[model samples]
Target: MTEPTDKVDEQPLDEYLKGGSSVSRQYRQLPGADVPPSLDRLVLRQAEEAVKRPSRPAWMRWTAPLAVAASAVLVVSIVLETGLRDETTVSAMQEKREAAEAPIETRMIEEPASEPSANAPAADSAAAELVMPVPPPPKIEVPPPASASEMPMTAVQRRAPPPPVAAPAPAPLEEQVAKAEERDNAAFVADVARQKSALEAAARERELSASQRAMRGEQAGVAGPRDTVETPEPKAVLSYSRPISASAVVTSADSMAKLEKTYTDPEAWLKDIRQLRKDNKPEEADRQWKLFVAAFPNYEVAENDTAREANK
Candidate 1:
């Protein structure tokens, strides 16, 4: 019975070692178990929180050490500088103290030595030998004064005086206006003189024509029933005719005449011309235009039908 029981136990053990049990087969056939969704979410959330947890800044990692090192360096430097300052100060103070004590030590030694003694003569001779006589001051030679020819010229003497500044230039606008006014006055005087001469000439011509007419009439009376002679028309006289020069003779009468009112101002003259045109006196306007052009050659006329027609 014991042997059979042993055999039974060995058979079961062999089956278990061979993995041929029903339990093992059933375990292999079962579906694989998965982690719970809640557990998985909890783990993942924990991982994220770990990842997101704020850590010390990278700069902070080195800042403390760097600050420590810098502070150490500063301290070392300060210590070294302080030590050097102290050494220099101590050295200067020691030198000053030594200098201050030197005069007192010298006085002490001289005072003891200066006391009367049995070997006074010997001491006196020793002191006399030790003490040196003061040296005489060096002589300064007086040089003779140099002659003017021998003396070197200074910078001020060599430099020449600056030239005088030139007078300021005249203002262009004022000068132009003055010159234009002078020209206008000259032209006006000349025109007046010319007009006066022309009037005088016209009067003379008319008188001569009348005298000839009378003489012919007398002749006709003497020679009766001859063909009637036609009297020639007198030439048309121009107003404001003038030579352009200072030599023109302007009489006081001409200046005082109503003709001077025509061209006193260029604008006024233009207005008169415009007025003449408005009044249907084209011939008179045209003649005034010609005079205006001659007087003020550079003046710009206003664009109008009258000016255009006159220009044509």
Candidate 2:
């Protein structure tokens, strides 16, 4: 009831807005200018405009897209590389597995067993490339079948027959006897001939030496009687005991006749004389030729002086 008589009641905020307080009235009386509805909103809008200014950098906007693209490229590269490696590994593994499961066979090669030739090269490259060959078993030899007599001997063999002791062989009786006789006769004849020839040569040399001495004395005017001249003794001559008898018969009985007969053919004697000349036995050839001429004066071509000169 007291409030109704007073004329004014307690005011609410909306009523206070219609009638201003001291502070609000002062603000209202300042000027009739338009005020913003929200000061905070206006400040926010100014800050957004400052951020969009021309002088500000735009790098932040492009950074996110660049990073995303780089990440995507890196992921794609890693995936492709992984796929290739997996495919290669799978192919290699499959090939190895197939080879391991396959069957295997072994084969042998044969080669001749012989000594290498010395003329071949010291280092043979072909031999190095060759595979080693397996060695064959040793060969076994079978003995031949024994005869009936040899079978009994083989059964009776004790300690292998003492390895068959060999005996010295005897020389032939007839050949030995003939060789002994020939050697004895040859030695005897050679001794006799050598002695006779030595004696004859010594006598001839002495005689010639005495003659030369006498000639030297005579040249010096010293004279000597013929009976006082010194002479060498006559030498004994060697002759065969008996002539070899021939199957052909002749009328002449003396040794000279046999000599004439032997010299008549003249081929052997001529050949012997020629051989003596070839052997440089001129003294023996002279003696033999004189005898031949004396015995075979009627021989063919032997009587010719030209043939005799050629022989000399």
Candidate 3:
């Protein structure tokens, strides 16, 4: 029973190793961690020594140990036998001989030439330190000649490095939208202000042009008829259309009647005229102001008096 059990345990390991049926896998299932093949052979020798009997048959006593020793040699030779696979021709044999005798480190690094396999066995790490793979020669870039004529016909220039990727902004979508909207509103307000300024500028420019023309006319002994002269209409200032305040009353009545009601309150009348100016109805305000002056020439109101001159 013990013999059968021993055979069963050792059979697969020996078969895989000797038959070259994935020897690495067989080694992987060994009892110890990172147990080398040499160490394994030593351990097996010790195990055989322990299992031997002085009274056993001479044939069995020697044969078992001899078999175990043979297996160990076979394993060692198998790994070293890169030459045996190609024994067909003299050239192949010669190449194999050259490869077989080569240094272990050289054999490990370079491929056996005659074989089609470009694959080299992973060398033992202990032996790898002795002969490191030769470092690739340094690449020294020779600068172009100072004279343009001496420059190469086609020079290989390294491509520029790629631009760094920008990270996405941390702000939320709603915040971004709000910011964009705020910018748009600010731009709109600025444009409106510019347009208003342009209109006001155009009005001043027209006035200056008219004054220049009048000066020219006076120099030529010509007087423009005052009654026929139409005043330049004031341009409307751009502003938001505000909803009427609760306190602001909307009344539909004759301008004269409205003026008469506010006769006792000159400040109220002046405020109404200012409102008219703001509404771009300076001409109507001027007409009502004239009526007020006609109604009360002796009445002295500073605001009204200033407005009277401005209207004229």
State the C-alpha lDDT per candidate.
Answer: 0.42, 0.37, 0.37
Residue 276: error of model 2 in Å?
80
**Candidate topping lDDT:** 1
Model 1 scores worst on lDDT over the 10 consecutive residues at 134-143
Show the colliding residue pairs in model 3.
none
Model 3 residue runs over 4 Å out of place are: 1-171, 209-312
Residue by residue across 1-312, what tens digits does model 2's lDDT show?
Answer: 356635655565457777767778788789787667698789899999988888635887888899999999999988876776566455433422222111000000111101111212321322222212211111001122232222222211211222322213223433443453343233223322332334335534544544665555542112211211122111111222111111011112342233323332243355456557667888887777777666445443222222243545
Q: Name the lDDT value of residue 181 in candidate 1.
A: 37
lDDT of 1 by residue, 1-312 (tens): 247675467877788779879878899889989899999999999999988999888999999899999999999988977776666555533433333233223322333211222334543443333233211111101111133232232223212222232114335433543554343333333333333334334434445544565555543122211111111111111222221111111222332222225343334455566667767888888887887777655544433324324433
After superposition, candidate 2 runs with Cα above 4 Å error: 1-45, 48-58, 95-312
lDDT string for model 3 (228-303, tens) is 1112111211121111100011121232243224332233344455556657787978976776666445434332
Per-model TM-score, in order, reads 0.18, 0.18, 0.18
